[model samples]
Target: MFGAHTWRCGQRYDETMTLTLAPDVQHHAANAAGRDFVIGDLHGCVDALRYLLHKVGFDAAHDRLFSVGDLVDRGDQCEEALALLDKPWFYAVLGNHEDSLCAVAEGRLARHRWYAIGGGWAQGLSDHALATYAKRLRELPLVRVVGEGETRFNVLHAEFFGDDADLDAGRFDAEVRERMMWGRELAFNAARLPHYALSPTYCGHTPVRELRQIGSQTFIDTGAFIPEGRLTMVEALTSRQWSISVQAARAMGAAEMTLP
Candidate 1:
């Protein structure tokens, strides 16, 4: 782990330099019988997600949903969002928020720090509950390669500082892993050189006003927790996209829908 330093966005956090149990990378075979969808940071908006899934006619029997992570935090449906992990059709990578939660669960990060950064929903939870959530989140890979050949793409929470070879081999050191979950260079500076991931990499830690792509990297976090923000979903193979504002999703009776 990198030296304990102030995190991005000028937020000061006390991060313990400890190794994580999660695998750095994981691979999934292409969906032969159904379509694959990649969604932006959930931020605990499970109802909104359900609404979008219903709007898209998602078939749980055949289709799969991949998340860029931050599945919990800043919204009222955190438990519901985390519950998605139990569904076989849902997959996700680890985001920085999850990382902090893990640290807190392990007593490496202070609880107040986590609360200050949108994890307030966890304030009253029992220690066992927090540990359980952390354990589940720790099982998530930092990066996921989905599909194969020309249709293949990568899903991660944030920037990858290394080249395609490093990513392919999962040769990430602590610094690389930290950058993968928290880096924002690519999101803020589109023209920066060395955008060299071989596969189309989809990331979501840094929310953009709209879907933005630089080289092979796509930023899909549209700030669903913000008043004017919306949740974005993209089909991994076809690059087709759909989005709905939080208000709009709620107005559509999202709360009444169940995950399919």
Candidate 2:
């Protein structure tokens, strides 16, 4: 059960909860020459991502795309989606699905556990391939801070249950990282206090029908792998959005294949 703990409004921490320390954060300077975009969970929908990027006129040469993670699983093009990590302009924090991949690859978790949660794509993969994927995913930071000053914002796969100082200093432990990858209390509980004071934070683990914001924390997963869901992307500085429906993207792809 991920994030089984209950969280109440204004509550910062539960001292009784225990988790190890795993600190990793990545910082990027603002894209002064071009725009910066933060996208929702990929969930292996590389084609939809491509369509959305094309619609947005994303410039790979100058623009940057930051992901909320979950770059694998569910959809058919998991490998293609994961390869985006190699792109110089693409950056992502580690999502819970990626965390599970690491756990399974390192033998910390059972294969069945992973399979139960949309990991069927890796069933045929060799151990070496799995290890390679895990190694790359493990390098992703738990949180990514983009830009500076008022334009600055934070990107994490899930919830962050701390203040700006705690986030800035990277004081969260493994439990915190777990929550960052799997927690849903903030997204589920509308009354819960916002976690950060300085920079707005974007997260994706908990899927919603549309992009939502509670205080400074924004949720944008949008259920890209589901039948009726869509992959969403938002401009980091302006909150402008672009979305591509999964069904529509697939239909378009199929239609294109039949043509010249």
The global C-alpha lDDT for each of the candidates, from Candidate 1 onward, is 0.82, 0.79
Which residue pairs overlap in candidate 2's backbone?
Answer: 20-174
Give the 10-residue window scoring lowest on summed lDDT in candidate 1: 5-14
- Which one wins on TM-score? 1
Q: List the residue pairs that clash in candidate 1.
A: none
Model 2 Cα lDDT, one tens digit per residue, 1-260: 53442111111122554432334777888888988889999999887887777777778888999999899888888998888889988988888788778778877778887888889999999989998887677668788898777878999888887766677787665578668878888888868655457478889999999889977789999999998898999998685898887778767773233210
True-vs-predicted CA distance for residue 115, candidate 2, Å:
0.4
In terms of lDDT, the poorest run of 10 residues in model 2 is: 5-14
Residue ranges of candidate 2 with Cα displaced over 4 Å: 2-23, 192-195, 254-260
